[model samples]
Target: MPTDTRARMVTGAARMISRRGVDAMSLRELAEQEGVPLGSTYHHFPGGKAELVDAAVNHVGDRVAESIAGTRGQGTEHIVRWVLHAWRRILIKSDFRAGCPVLAAAVAKDERHRDTARAVFGRWTDGLIDVLIEDGVPPVRAPSVARTIIASLEGAVGLARAFGQIGPLDDVEAELIRLVAAAAGEPAPGAGR
Candidate 1:
């Protein structure tokens, strides 16, 4: 049952982190919310809060990355819409109380947690790169376009959540779709230079 409790605690931590952000999710609160014994947290995460927080970051990132992969053959517009609406739904469902854990973790004081967030972001970027390449984006331009899309998504979502509106996401959708199309239609960046 300890293993189950540990998993519950980790899953709960992700939810808590989403709603409260990394800086605000205390271990005691997580324990109580998850209905796990306080000691179970230590047993499951010997490295303590940083470990749990980073784990939550990975947990969230993994789920989103899986969603990205599941979008194979969905086209750039569908993929972009899927990504945007996912965040939109997360915000709208939670009444703007919840946000992205990866965004929260990216600002963590613990270097390890931030590093985990970076790795997760990198993995997401890689997944998008594959999708864009498969969508006919030139291989050389896919990486840059993918990174740009990620940056835009992250920033736009952050702004959208801050304002409790989806305008930022809507605004970026057209821009990113155009950007991806241009990447596919144009020569690789610096091809002449």
Candidate 2:
């Protein structure tokens, strides 16, 4: 099998496993979703389901890191806008069907899967903290702020999915922007928060 085909299979399987828990996923299902031959799947991931799943998790995590890196623009407002845009894009593009990918993996029954999720999540949070510190937030507070920002976004995603509406995300984004600005000692907009 081609490397691109195997990569597509990894992403498709991850998305499917996220929508339906890991227990509901199988190698054949992933191959079908990727429109690849079942035999090709084994050729790529000889270890089978576990190997494919781990690869998917890592692939998604790398994407998350790239997204974060892309969001580091001119200033704090730029970063906030970028973050908000990312969520809006995710919600609109996905039809609000799934929550955070890391959160989805975190809920997996298998300990190995959960650990994979945690490591990815930790990398994302640490990346955010690094960006915050770069943007003038005090180093000591960066990690806490990053964790809070992640929590707020994750919580908002959950509420949006649960209520079938996007209002909660909007509200959370508003407060998050204010908090990020305040932490950086930037001039908050008059209507902020």
Candidate 3:
């Protein structure tokens, strides 16, 4: 847990949004949940829910991008498996209650939320493309392949949540590993155990 009130609020907002989405995530409830005064939330985020939501989305995006970047030189399969497993653990740990905050924001009615989601998704896609290219995927093919992996994984997370099972994530992980392997002109590795 973050000791700083603002950081804790943003992290709590991201967690809340992951499960219930932006529209349903109340700043008041989040402030209460974080044991902070509602006034403090306004003090930290004067722009209110929109500002907090933006920070939450960016927080999650930056974390994911940093993790992906950290896996550089580990090969596409490792990166793919690492990402899949990370999401899988989140699903299992939360008991299927949570999905991607970025996805939740992407489908928000607010144009600002959608725009933020787009930028976050774009950052993730660009990072994945770079990793793929480094791992031997041609630049032209990297973009589409990176997008496919992201889209598939995001959809799988939704399915896993909807079905209250991790099967969708597992299935997508296997196929994505195969796809990345083929794109990199290497033999496909089995899904990580």
Q: How many residue pairs collide in each prediction?
A: 0, 0, 0
lDDT of 1 by residue, 96-142 (tens): 77777888888877778789989999999999989899888988888
RMSD to the true structure for each prediction, in A, is 2.3, 5.0, 5.5
TM-score top scorer: 3
The sequence of per-residue lDDT tens digits that candidate 3 reaches over residues 1-193 is 4449989999999999999999999988898899999998889888999999999999999999988888888877787788788888898899999989999999998999999999999998998998999888877788899999899989999899899988998899889988987888843344243
lDDT of each: 0.85, 0.77, 0.89
| lDDT head-to-head 1 vs 3, winner | 3
Estimate the lDDT of model 1. 0.85
Q: Which one is best on lDDT?
A: 3
TM-score list, all predictions: 0.90, 0.85, 0.92
Question: What ranges in model 3 sit over 4 Å off?
Answer: 1-3, 186-193
Candidate 1 vs candidate 2: which has greater lDDT?
1
